[model samples]
Each structure stands twice: as C-alpha cells, then as structure tokens.
Target: MSEPAEDPQELAALRNEIDEVEREVVRTVDLGPRAVVIAAAVFVLIVGLVLPWMGGANGLEVLLGQHEAVGKASWVPRLFATTSIGFGVLGSALAIITRRWALTWVCALGGWFASVDGVLAIWSRQSSAGPGASAPGIGLIIAEIATVVIASLWFRTAWSRS
Candidate 1:
C-alpha cells in the first residue's frame, strides 16, 4: 500500500517560519561603518603583537614567557597581553563575523577591560624600569591605543543600535 502524503499547508507554514528566523538572524548583525572601523583597530592590535613589547622581545614572546624580560616582567603586562589577544583579537573577530548585537556588547565591555589592563601594563613597565627591567616598548603602546579605539567604536555601535 502507498504511504499517506504530508499536509501541504503544514509544510508551507514550517518553511515560512524557517525563513522568518533566517531573516531575523541576518537583521541582528551589524554590517555598517562602525563594524569596519572596529575591525581595522583589531588589525592594528594584531600587528602590535609582532612588534617589540618588552626588552627586545615581541608581544608574542612576552605572552609566552619565553623572553629574557619575562623573568622580570610583572603580572600586569602579561595580563594585558592575554586580554588583548582574548578580547581585542578573538572577541572582536567573533563579533564581526557573527554580526550579533549581543556579541557586540560583550566585545565592547571586554575591550574596555582590556584597555584598563593595557594602562596598568604600561604603568608597571615604567615603574619597574631598572638596570635589567625594560620600559614599555612601541608595540605595547600601539596595542593600548588600538584597544581603546576598538572599545570606543564598539561602545558607539552598541549605543546606537535600537
């Protein structure tokens, strides 16, 4: 015997519901100029990673604790590196890719927190400067600036969204 056919009306309703969800998802993403600016700042933060941060070591080396400066480096600078990578790089990337408003808020808050970490990192480096200790390098400064920019842009974007 042949199986009964599915209800066409029910199938059409399900398809319509799926389409509405897809549209809603697309609508929640922020693909405007602010997002582009935030992405650019994140790029700068990434570039800062490869530049000199502590002593002669790059940001990555300092983060990995593989440099000579690592022995004398304070916890603040290390924490700054970790947050920069976590929120500045990874969180921003996820927010941009997902285009979700909630993610944007999360990234914005994380960026602000990272910016604080950056300031503390710089202060730690300056205060600890001695014969063996190194001052904050150009890369660290750049990363701090980038983090601030990202945080500001994300804040503006989140605020403007309805």
Candidate 2:
C-alpha cells in the first residue's frame, strides 16, 4: 500500500515556499536593467544642460557634435535638446529624492531617449560619411549598453534577497 499523502498544512507550506522562491527569482531578473537605465538617464540629463551651455568635450558635445555655427542648429533642434536635458535632470532628481519607482521609470525613459540620441548621432555620421565613419562615440554606446546590463543584473540580485 502507498504511504499516506502529506498533510494539507505541510502541502500548503511547500506551495508557499515555492511561490516565494519564484518571486525572488523574478525580482532578481528585473533589477539590473532598471538601475542601469535610471543611471543612464541621469547621465544624459547632465550632458544635456552642461553641454549646450558650456560647450566642451563632454558627452553631449561628443555625442551630438558641436554647433560651431549656432545658425546651423535651428530653433527646433535646440529646443528639443534643451527640453530633453531639463526633463532628464528634473525627473532623475525627483526619483533619487523620493526613492519612487515611478520616478525611476521616468528617468529610464529619458535614458532611452539619450540612448536613441546616441544611436541617431552615430547614424547621422554614417550617412554623411563624416568622422563617425571611423566609429567615434561608439564607446559611449557600448558604455550605455553596459550600464543597462550591469544595472539590471545588480538590481535583480539585490532585490532578490528581500
């Protein structure tokens, strides 16, 4: 004859344990990307403001190219870049201050925008057969990607313990 089945309480306890484990796994898998994206967004914000005003070898100028001819950079492009930078800085600050995930998401979106900007800059160089043809600023793209991956993994691992 077969042995008696596990008690209902024991079975339920085992199920709960399994559920807990699954939750931890899910949390671990998600944290790294979130953190990376947020950090990247903050970086973008800083570049956005300081680059336009200061105009130097910083990430902004490097990524978007200098506007040696202010006339060459029209109002629309300038407006957009300025807006993005301001938003990035504000959103990131809010997130950091409040420790709110929603704010973090805003920061991530800005990061996404920054990443896109980087990609577009690279593309423009390729199309124009400009200096970007040599794959300049490629390092920034790699760094951003690396940031995303590392942050995601770190977030996942840290949250898993909770």
- Candidate 2 TM-score over all chains jointly: 0.39
**What does candidate 1's lDDT look like per residue over 51-154, in tens digits?**
89888888888888888777755678888899999988998898888888888788889999999999999998888956768888999999999999998888
Model 1 steric clash total? 0
Give the candidate number with the greatest lDDT. 1
Clashing pairs in 2: 28-156, 31-155, 31-156, 32-151, 32-152, 32-153, 33-152
Q: Which stretches of candidate 1 lie over 4 Å from their true place?
A: 1-27
Q: Write the per-residue lDDT of candidate 2 for residues 17-100, one digit (tens) a residue.
A: 999998665433234455455566456445444433212233444436464522233233343344345444565455555554
Q: What is the TM-score of each candidate against the true structure?
A: 0.83, 0.39
Error of 1 at 45 (Å): 0.7
- RMSD to the true structure for each prediction, in A, is 5.5, 9.5
